[model samples]
Target: MTHATTTDGVRIAYQLQGQGAPLVLLAGQANNHHWWDQVRADFHPARSTLTLDYRGTGDSDKPDAPYSTELFAEDVIAVLDRLGIDRADVYGTSMGGRVAQQLAARHPHRVAALVLGCTSPGGPHGVERSNDVRKALAQPRPEAARQALLELMYTPRWLDSHPGPHHTLGDPGMPAHARRHHLAASNRHDAWELLPDIAAPTLVIHGADDLLNPAANAPLLADRIPGARLELIPQARHAYFEEFRALAGPLVLDFLTTAPSRP
Candidate 1:
């Protein structure tokens, strides 16, 4: 475990594992570095992975302020700077993907490659969640909220077969205040206009049955980011990396390891 202090003086926690080229893993809203535990090994042997807790998640400082994607992006940059890493392949899921967009757009040189999974650009162009899911997410109680999240994240068959995975639903242990801030940041995030400015080799992956961030957003991301590749996993949902790690893992590994072809 390691710590990096952001420009705002918030201490962010991170972990470094495996050995090879640096690969940064960013988690979704209200999740921390530990969220990657299940898939962290997928990139081992060929790449060294860095997983960080975004402010307000994991062991990071939970400052009482409105969070934004730009803030999270800066936090990630701080982590890299603290570790003395000049460049790395960056991968983000959901809210983390939103932050990755900001990082690549704002500091393109730091990102050698980019991968976004089950995330949206936000704003009018992005898909909005259904009211039922939204209400469930606002359940106020931790257990209820976790249940709501599981329902929204996994398909029925996957949930039925893997009942134990429910423990992973809210494993980040985010406080209610911090979660509210994260949710606010997510609601306000808008990267549609900024996608074209990303210069790194990029890959966009999404689950075909994703509900939180519809799979339709994948094409928009792939098309907007020049030279970006898109891959859609069938019979998967929002947390495809965990629900279908067997399939999503290899696709991500290949994209991160292989060189991008010139257009």
Candidate 2:
């Protein structure tokens, strides 16, 4: 584990493994470095992967402060600068995808390629989650929410084998205030106007049945971003990156590993 100090004095924690081209894995809202635990091995040896804990998650400082995708993006820049990596391929899921939007739009020179999963450009232009999906995600009790999340994330077939939800599901295990901050930041993320600013080759991939972010948003993103590609995993849900990694992993790996960097 290594720590990088952001300009704001927050100590961002990150883990780097393997060797080859750098690939930064950004976790969803309220999640930490462990977000990539399931699929990290799939990309092993083929690429060097880095995963970081966002503020208020894992080993990073969880101060009582407001958070935004823009700030989260800057924190990633701090980590990259600390490691002297000029540019890297980035894969971001859920809220991390929101931050990735900010990163690639705000710091185009730092990203070689980009992959966004199960997330959307927030605000008025973005599609909102269904009431049923919201109810499933918010069950009053944490345990109930976790249970509901499992159903919302994984298909019944996956649930037959995988009994429990990941610890990093929903707001993760963060303070109530920090969890609120994460949701707020994710809610406010409006990359609709900023989408066209991204210069890196981008892939917008999602689950066909993602009620949380909704698969319908994928086309909007792919259409807005110049030269971006769209891919949908059939019958998958919000957490397809985790539940359908076999398909999602290779698709993302191939795009990032082969896309030409900025000249």
Candidate 3:
């Protein structure tokens, strides 16, 4: 366990695993570092991996204010400064992708490569949800919010096979109020116009059946970012990492380890 103080005074909780080049992973919206547990094993132990819980989501301090994607980027910069890491490969999933994009645009020197998963540009047909789904997520009831999350994010097969909805009242023991706030934070995020400025070796991965963020988003991102490659996993859902942890982990490890970094 480690802590880093952002410029805004929020103490971010993080852990470092492995020992080669540093890799910073920004988790999805409403999630903590545990989200990366399954994928961590795929990396070479010689490489360093940094996974952190964003404010209001995990062990970090949750302040009462409107959270934006920029703040999340700042949090990443703070971690880098605190750890004395000058450069790193960055990965973000879902809402975290918004932060990763902002980080590359705003601080290109610190980023060696970028990987975006299950995310979109927030353009037309992106991860924007329907009014009913949005309303359900905002509901104070845990069950309602959990159901909303499952419906908007997961595919039918994933829900049937996983233990998500069965224990929706408090699936991971996180409180209803916290989940609601986290959901709100995810909903408030949008960054469609900033893709062009990301100047790094980039990889965009998405699932074919991501209803929340359509698979079409992968092409849009690749088209905008010069030389960015898009890889789509057929029949996978929004939570593809969880649904196919074994497959997803290795793919990410291969990309991060194989990509050549500029000197």
Candidate 4:
């Protein structure tokens, strides 16, 4: 329910929980802080968590102006500064990972450790999603599109047994232009050259079955980053963090707790 005003005048909304060292959890594209609902508890007792809504997502202000991952990083910094947090560990997935790249590269002193999940370094060097997945994602029908996304997110076995709720895109009230702007920002993210400059202890994790962001990019991200570790969850898809939260969550926690702030 708390808020921070970014330098650009956008109102960024965020929530803080738990106690001990600070750990900011960044959500995927068009998603708010709630994207970490399934895993935040995993970090409890060890690290406090901060989750914020991106400019056009969740409870944050949505302006018609263009957005980029770099701007999103600044928004995060403004919130940290507002709260008087000097440095923290950061974990980001999907679009948020792109923003983390900017944060760590541009403000190395501000990050203690970093974890990027199911994300890619965009630009010409990044591998694009398969045409099949892209076409299914293009389905205009809401119900059909939801099913398609659910399929991409989890294996049939898990979906058949759990049949639980899942989050999609941003708020139902988000304007069309904001959604377009979010997609454009993610599409434009290019941190390949900047990856080497990231000094935070880092881990790049992804799903081997991911079609949205090919698993190949995970190695590329790990290889480019000075000493980033790479992990791929077999049989997991785009939503590996959720589909295999039990596994993915611990792996992240171990790396964060054991790795030195910088090498």
TM-scores for every candidate against the unseen true structure: 0.93, 0.96, 0.84, 0.97
lDDT of 4 by residue, 1-263 (tens): 78999987999999999999999999888888877887798898689999999998878999999999999999999999989999999999989899999999999999999999999999988999988998898899988877888888788998898686666344566678888999999999999999999999999999999887888999999999998999999999988988798999899999999998553
Locate the minimum summed-lDDT window of 10 residues in model 4: 164-173
Q: List runs of model 3 lying over 4 Å from the truth.
A: 123-127, 130-141, 144-148, 151-185
The residue pairs in collision within model 2 are: none
| Ranking according to lDDT, highest score first | 4, 2, 1, 3
Instruction: State the displacement of the C-alpha of residue 117, model 3, in Å, after optimal TM-score superposition.
Output: 0.4
Candidate 3 colliding pairs: 19-46, 19-47, 20-46, 20-47, 20-48
- Candidate 2 C-alpha lDDT tens digits along 100-188: 99999999999999999988988898899889878877678987887777777788898899875474474346888888898899998
- Where does model 1 exceed 4 Å of error? 139-145, 165-168, 261-263
Local distance difference test scores for all models: 0.87, 0.88, 0.76, 0.90
- Prediction-by-prediction clash tally: 0, 0, 5, 0
Which regions of candidate 2 are displaced past 4 Å?
A: 170-172
Kindly list the per-residue Cα lDDT of model 1 for residues 1-263, writing each as its tens digit.
Answer: 57999888999998999899989998888887767887789889689999888888888899988999999999999999999998889999999899999999999989989999999989998878778777887798978987777866888888888786443454357788898999899999999999999999999999998877788889989988998899999988898998899999888888877856322
Candidate 4 TM-score over all chains jointly:
0.97
Q: Output the TM-score of candidate 1.
A: 0.93
